[model samples]
Target chain A: MEKNKIRSDHPLDAMLRTDRIPHIWCPGCGIGTAFSACMVAMQASGINLDKTVMVSGIGCSGRGAGYTRLDSYHTTHGRAIPFASGMKLANPELNVVVFSGDGDLFAIGGNHFIHAARRNMDITVICVNNLIYGMTGGQAAATTPCLAKTTTTPLGNPDPPFSLPLLAFASGATYVARWTILHTRDLTKSIEEALNRRGFSFIEVLAPCPTGYGRKNKERSLDTLKIYQERTVIKNGAHPMDAVMDFGNSITLGKFVDHDRPTFSDNYDRTCRPHFA
Target chain B: MKPAVLTGEHFMTGDVACAEGALAAGCLFFGGYPITPATEIAEHMASRLPDVCGTFVQMEDEIAAMASILGASCAGVKSMTATSGPGFSLIMENLGLGICTETPCVVVNVQRAGPSTGLPTLGAQGDMMQARWGSHGHYEIIALAPASPQELFYTTITAFNLSETYRIPVLVMTDEVTGHLSERVVIPEAGAIKLRHRPAPKGRKDRFKAFQPGPNGVAPMAIAGDGYGIHVTGLTHDERGYPGMNVETQIEMMHRLTQKIRNNLDDIIRTESYRLEDAEIVIVSYGISARSSLAAVDEARAQGIKAGLFRLITVWPFPEQQIQKLAEKVRGFVTVEINLGQIHLEVQRCAGSRVPAVLVGHPGGAVITPEQIVDTLKTAF
Candidate 1:
């Protein structure tokens, strides 16, 4: 199937299965870039692609599951975490990954996010922070940076944005990282690291929604990628406390935290063993 | 004729037996909150599931408990959740999702009083109607009522089987009294039990469509990330699984969903007829109330009255044809229930104009006594 296809000049073309192409992504969408990074990361990690189950919630980013020519599920909005948690417990051998948008993961599913992290379930959550709701036509999202213009936030958003990596860290995720689309290799490495991690791993990739959010904020097309790359700084020996100062404009984008905690299922199995026996 | 084997044994209440029945059904995962009489079932599952390498999680609330079980079921496990009226009410929305998504699982409702926090520990069968149409939208459901703990255990197994066989949610609707009652239920050996499995779609890679129904109208369910084109949504979906957004598609989807159970009603509905052979007075009942009706039948027969009991094992599909045929021979029908008579209406509908069907109602925590049923029967006669 790979040898027969006419490869487009797009760098992502090599990683994507061409037959499943004519992708659902809109023109100038950074989701495609994120998708490319995800594919590269999966390919690089040497994890069993066949055993990898992708669970996604409702949103533009949720469609990532449908595009991946692997075993994936497009679940109900904001409900992918529980489903992914179940899959991991059912088959500890299988790799479970949740791909969701900012709105899907943080706003509506915020409660689930914290608890799943707190329990340290063995799963990877790759949150695509687009700053606004893209599928529903540029509504202000939980991560829509304050003063950023959206259809819902025409005069600019009054609500403050969420620092996703710090939130995950506080919620007890064993691994937390952030990256932008421009740093393709960095984003891939973060995803690779999250997948290989044994406990709940969360990665927030600042993906540009060139059509809705990007156009409204006056940073449309691939130019948004350049802006993100220039504005974000990679921090070495960074603690989650550092994220507090960089909230407004400058953002820290790198492997922010990586540690260990007993996963929910592992602890549950241990606690329940004596009773079942 | 051989002498009749008169074995009338009274044992512990129904609720205790229900707990034992769940253990017998091989239920390993139970996610529920403690609500009234239903709490015993949860307590039992909590204590027992671990012993069998099963899981029991008392979620923060009933909504999560219901949703979590649906998730666990998708992960290829037999799971259940137990609750009363309030908790059951909270689960209605997800129950509808369970129907549309075709997730196989069980919900045990130990009936309690009222619209809101009725009688907390009290008994009432008010949830009878909720079990059928409590969930939003139009979809079919399979419900069962156990008159004994033996039936509770057996019905739970049957509930699991029906859920798996049809790929739909099954409700084990036990009233507060039955949920609390205990009895000597014979646990069948593992080999003697028949476990139903749906048609599993083969070929791990992309050839599988998760919602595609087989010849039996039950589509094979694959765990998420099984490397298949598995797109499940709460929306009206086509066989290919992308959203179908058309009137024709909606109509076709509803028809298939409704017909899957309606067409298989014969195999799905089960009931028991006691002394129905030559009886002129028939009392139809189910759940805990059936025990009272059974006693009423015997008392009426002792008084030279031609009386019998028709106990419903499968409550939702409502053994219509059998009741319609029985109505031909019976002079009158008495429907006894714990609620202000829900299943009685179903019996009345099935009985048609063939006989006068009267309801002996008790819309409270107390069980409908056999004397009350006998009085109604005598008055009708």
Candidate 2:
């Protein structure tokens, strides 16, 4: 009998620790999709795997570093950016990437994220915004939409959500972009571009937490994806301030900031090289 | 080119001496936030690190500084951070993470008085007990106290070496007096300074377990970006370094974490005895208070009292055995510290009901005078 023609192997198998999977992601969670996009982007970037390190904070999305078959660190909550920055600055040859959730990155780690960007630290930060804290349960997050129902926000979320692209841009990120899980190819390409960028590059991927955010909102995975498809408008060169996310309104997606500037290490070397000499 | 270690005798504060010691130990990364008493150490490091091709990062907060050092260490470089009492409290959560991950790093807490930032510029040993039990978990720690600038210089190097050797975070618990007091410190040649590095795993990289113990019960470390593809987590993990939440796994992990330091207590614990052989009254002290205790002991000796000083060089493993043994020989024990009865409780616990233990301590803002310690010594009898 002839063997089946379809290939069973996955392209990301070599880049992942297969023994640790099936992963801890919920059945309909979009973090898996975002994580896969990142893996494929790293592969496409053609960077040295041995010289690449992934750092993550405490959350469901933080598990990306553990699953990746690379030099990775699972750091304390809200600390992945600084940890990755240390790796990048200590040895400039290492390719450092921080993968964590919006709650971890924006709430507790917000200062680190903004400061690193302002300093133009040479690192890639891939933040998966699931609108809620998935790992600790369906709690309200810094990225949760206004009027959204969460465990912490039982009645309704009164606080306005952060415009991640605007924050990254305002904080001096040399490269900034936003995408959703529905736009897999664009998200993958953006990550690849961010990986090759010279300064602090940030890509915020809006993902669905079906078990946490979706369960409370009474929306399924497909419904969330449909919302992304219907609301997101691609505006590559639009001003960052105009890219705010209002769940009922339009959500702008695409690279909002791309500029050339001296990174933290480059400036340090320029200023301190004479002293060393 | 400027040398990493400045050889010869020079007058410097304990904070500067500690920075020099870190440089001499080949610490390539210094990540810290500026807190009073400890801020001088960070300032000194900022100026010196770049000269020696080292990295100095002023992290946004103490927690981030702690996390940054752990990351740099995991990247296979010796790393450290310095802070004060409030900052130390901020670092406790990540300090536990560093312990659970078995990352090698040094945390220097140049203590100030605090229930909540009581006195930032004054001297206090208020963090002694907190250094031992600050992080919310059950794990053995190595902490050293330096009474003088000279001791600070040497103890900082020892702190780095012990952290690397044990694959755990080591604490250098200094006080405001020791940290700011300027004194002469002798620096040796870099070649003569002893250093220890984290050993690499000896097995195949693919099959290597990140937390599997070697002969010393410390798992050989594989640095980040070394192609080991290892996963490290703060949660209780097995030998493979994967998170395992069951009771059995928790027991095994906790035992290994505690046993590594407990089993090797002989090598880790250090204490200095000044005329302790034939003394009836013993003063148990550390940090700046140890100096005052020494003066009091000498005055007592001149007046014909059988008094001696037991200075704690390594405060954490408590030196319980030596204290227990000394309790059997001495009539009473007095602990002199800046805070109110921190280490005195430990002395009392060790001395038990057989011999009485007294405390010679103050609130903060001032060091305990020799007269106060002498009064306590006289009253103890």
Candidate 3:
């Protein structure tokens, strides 16, 4: 039966390296869904795909740069923002996108994130928030929920988590939004919107790590998605400060902030490039 | 665009000269942080890069500065960064990343005294060994040591050209004294200065292999928007630039990275010799210390001592052959430098039992004087 079966082309074959199809992403992992949503947004948006480049830091989601059929870079851990900024600044015609996980973007790469947003560097940053450091045996992460069980938090997580959207908005990101991987349609549309925007755009996609986080949390992958379906409340155009992710309560999911200001390139050209002939 | 070269003689500090050298070499992007001694390089670049329609970004820290230059280089621009010892330590991992990914760029280290900010205002050659082995793995690196502001200008240009030719980060290891010293630097006509550019990718984009080596062992580089869709990573990769996790791929990649440098020793390594014919004593040095060593060699020659100067222009790839040849003819060797014997150790190792290799060394904070070398030379004999 296997030998007789005819081959079929996947919809994303053009954007993906299908020969490397057996990706390291585990079954029931939400990272694959989040990655798929990003690809869909890339296609749906009208940007020239040839001019697009993907950059990733070290982690499970960092593999996104390696899988994409585009000019891509997998930089050192927590360095994707600066790396992406360099590429964008060097060639303003190229579209630079940074794709990585929570531990990478929020913890180690936190300083770069805030500074890039403060300068309003023209780039898109998609962060997959799995709550725990999934690649390193489910250690507690900056986004890990309070009282969540993980390897580092043997008893429970004692520290409060960072509100990623609030942080992005406060750091001067022009576009800020959040959605679960289960909210594929909303996530894809939001990513497309961010991609087309001019200033620093950040999209936080809450993903489930069944093997890494779920096993220790006493929840299965299906249960996590079911929780998202039942617990999430969509509230578009809400203040980004109000966007919350308290698993004990209803999760706030929506586009939180959208505005515009002069980007770094625009400011540089105006102030520094007097001889920009 | 503004002409990159100034095309005249100007009195400038070594740091400023290094910046002009970068401009002459066609470096379009400079991403660096502000650290003492090296901060002038960043400041000069920040002010001058705009004139050429290029970009100069002061990153959040040294790590980001390193990352930014690597990114800029991979995007088809000759890029660079400058820092001191503390910053250099922070940039080590990204330096390794540049090596692993075969990105062409330059890193200028205006080295100062350190173990931990030992003396920010003082000069030292303590990083001579660190420049060779600081980046965590066993890989070959090219480092040039310049003795004066004038030499720094030429060395910086040579650094960029070498990096482009060999797909590796070249280090301009200038000292605090050289960086701060002012001297006359003749910037020739832009056309007179030679430049080297990275190989450009050609053929069908679909069939193009990003890491597939040319006859020179350097693969053609493709930047973003080139439509070649190259994947670059710090992970071990194959000729196609895809990650290969196994040992065979690691062996192939490591061998390729090291051999790319090893095979081109002639083109990569450089040195300067002064009054060596029919001499029995050799005084070896580089950078700031080499300045006094030149004076010492001449003074010794005047004093009826048959001494010669062997100044190291390119410090790493060690110049083992030159030392071996010199050891065979010279009665003894004298290495002078700041920092307690860094490259002196290299001289000692290379000279072996053929002759005694004595170090005229200091432990940071002060310059090694020609008189001190004269004293050591008189005593060692």
lDDT of each: 0.79, 0.91, 0.92
Clashing pairs in 3: none
- Of the two candidates 1 and 2, the one with more favorable lDDT, higher being better, is 2
Displacement of the residue A42 alpha carbon in candidate 2, Å: 0.7
Q: What is the lDDT of residue B325 in candidate 3?
A: 91
TM-score of 1: 0.87
Q: Across residues B1-381, which tens digit of lDDT does each residue of candidate 1 receive?
A: 111111233364565555555555556677788888788788866766666777777665676677678777776777788889999997786687778878888998888888788898888878888998898787899999987776777788889889988989899998877767666656656666677865677764456667777777877787654555466666787765556669987887787788889989988999988999999988888888888989999998988889999899898977888889988888988888887879888888988887888989886879888888888887877
Question: What's the true lDDT of residue A54 in model 1?
Answer: 79
**RMSD in angstroms, all models?**
5.3, 1.4, 1.7
**Which one wins on DockQ?**
3
Error of 3 at A110 (Å): 0.7
Candidate with the larger lDDT of 2 and 3: 3
lDDT of 2 by residue, B1-381 (tens): 568999999999999999999999998899999899899999998888888888888988998898888888888889999999999999998899899999999999998888788899998988888898999978899999999999999999999999999999999999988999999999999899989988788868999999988898888998887888888888788998887879999999998898889889888998999989999999999999999999999998888888999999999989998999999989999989998988889999999999999898899889888988888777768
Residue A235 shift from truth in candidate 1, angstroms: 2.3
Chain B TM-score, structure 3: 0.98
Candidate 1: lDDT of B13?
53
Largest lDDT belongs to which candidate?
3
For candidate 3, give the lDDT of residue A67. Answer: 91
